[model samples]
Target: MFKIHEIREIIKLIDQSSIKEFELEIEGSKVTIKKSGGVVEEKVQTIVAQAPAAPVAAAPAPAAQAAPVQPAAQPAANTQVPEENLHQILSPMVGTFYSAPEPGASAFVQVGDKVTPNKVVCIVEAMKLFNEIEAEVTGEIVKVLVQDGQLVEYGQPLFLVKPE
Candidate 1:
């Protein structure tokens, strides 16, 4: 079972660390932590073993069990530069920052790019999932505060936009 305080601590760690993704294996259980848009999300899975009935005691002993496998968690994608002189766009969740949907892909928005409210300017990945972040104000991109794949904290400045 995942405890709320533990999760909060993990989130705080993620916020403070430069690493965007973190994983741990404990007692045959796997835990993964990711931060995006200033939000931290975690996933935990426990592997349980079932004992065989007495009737099977005579059978050859089962091969030694292997260590539990942790699922491959994908980090968040996309980070956009907000314009200067405009309201700064802050991360709402903790996760990895991406400049594009994938490696080698063009970024969603760039410096000098015009943005409007409701336009998806970036994406924050949490818990192996991608979440699109929209621009909340109409403006021109001025600066990018976070680098791609960098871990960000809650309320962290993502971009500085200049109003159009």
Candidate 2:
């Protein structure tokens, strides 16, 4: 099931982008978001395969929600400088984010850490494949957006850097 924050983030991103419709289906669950007349609407649906021997409980389907699009607010810490000045490191795929190489290991990068374009900043595990994410900009890390082991969506901002 998709978390509320995740759904909200998806909606926010869609509102900021030019895409009018977006859909994603995973493991029989589907989420669709559409923008119309300056309003955003989202529908979430879950499908379950059932066996004849045992019946599953019937639940009411979720209804689509429409919300007015609003400009996203910048975090207090990041408001010091304009967002245009910060370089955002974005995820290339949907996956779970890992700060360290393995359990109990030190994080690859931290706030205030200087990084080069080739620096491996984190790992994103998708479908059992661990992909190393690099800091494509030469700068000092300014913010770590997502927590360790958090599920991240494609194009999500993983880190913000102040270019040197």
Candidate 3:
């Protein structure tokens, strides 16, 4: 029979090791442990010489349901824009925004520059990976909302574009 102290010791050992799975069997008692990446799962199983049959019962039928009715809703929400006539290009992820590819290099796109959908506008560094941001709409950049090496939030406006 495994004691509480033995189980604690085993858990400590498993925590200290990088091994993902461990099993032990002694005197008809079995223990199985598994770890996923850094998560730990402990399971214990005991086998008896004889097992009793379980009683069965009939399950009730599910209740009848009605179909849902669609409600009339507004198709679009309106946002009042300033007189600048510019559409905002928002950041898709939270990271450090960079205007240029490298230090002292010219920016990928500048204010008053025409940008196409395929044009690379900037780089955002997240989790040690440098991700290049692309312009999704073809337009002329009217304003840069963020500075180089600045920390940006998700969905924050990075650039303003004036449609051609």
Per-prediction count of colliding residue pairs? 26, 0, 0
What tens-digit string does per-residue lDDT give for candidate 1 at 52-112? 2222212221112221222213322333433233577777665677878888999998877
Q: For each candidate, what is the lDDT?
A: 0.59, 0.67, 0.59
Give lDDT tens digits, candidate 2, residues 1-164.
76667666555554443344556677666767655554433444642221112121332122222222222234213536566899988877656889999999999998889999999999998656789999998998888888888766566688889999
Clashing pairs in 3: none
Q: Mark the 10 consecutive residues where model 3 has the least summed lDDT.
A: 60-69
Worst 10 residues of 2 by lDDT: 47-56
* C-alpha TM-score for every candidate: 0.53, 0.55, 0.50
Q: Identify the candidate with maximal lDDT.
A: 2
Can you list the residue pairs that collide in candidate 2? Answer: none
- Model 2, position 21, has a per-residue lDDT of 50
Candidate with best TM-score: 2
> How does residue 149 of candidate 1 score in lDDT?
82
